[model samples]
Target: MPCIRDLRIPVSTILGQLATGRAAGEILEDFPDLEPDDILAALEYAAAAVQERELPLAAR
Candidate 1:
């Protein structure tokens, strides 16, 4: 599978950090190998993937 920006860091790892309410700065600070743009790219990749899925809507 393709990793993030040619690094071994997977996008899932970045997403997990965001999911746990970790701030972008915190993630970057904790993971010196990552960049601010890496977080943004991971989010964008996740958003695109979600858009391709079929989600159930609430009852109107």
Candidate 2:
């Protein structure tokens, strides 16, 4: 499945930078190809992935 815009970078890589205390501006600066929305999308995608639940878990 598609994870990031244009696949220039993986969402996990973005999350890794974020986890290492990289600011949004820093990320943008480091990855000139990435837009602000790409970062936002990565966060949103991560949140959605974490929020998803299996059928049995949801039923419980």
lDDT of each: 0.88, 0.88
The TM-score obtained by model 1 is: 0.78
Error of 1 at 36 (Å): 0.6
Q: Could you tell me how far off, in angstroms, the CA of residue 59 lies in candidate 2 after the best superposition?
A: 12
TM-scores, each model vs. reference = 0.78, 0.79
Model 1, span 1-60: residue lDDT tens: 546897888889989989999999999998898889999999999898878667799998
Candidate 2's residue-wise lDDT over 1-60, tens digit each?
Answer: 435787658899999999999999999998898989999999999898899676754553
Cα RMSD of predicted structure 1: 5.6
Query: Candidate 2 has which clashing residue pairs, if any?
Result: none
Number of clashes in every candidate structure?
0, 0
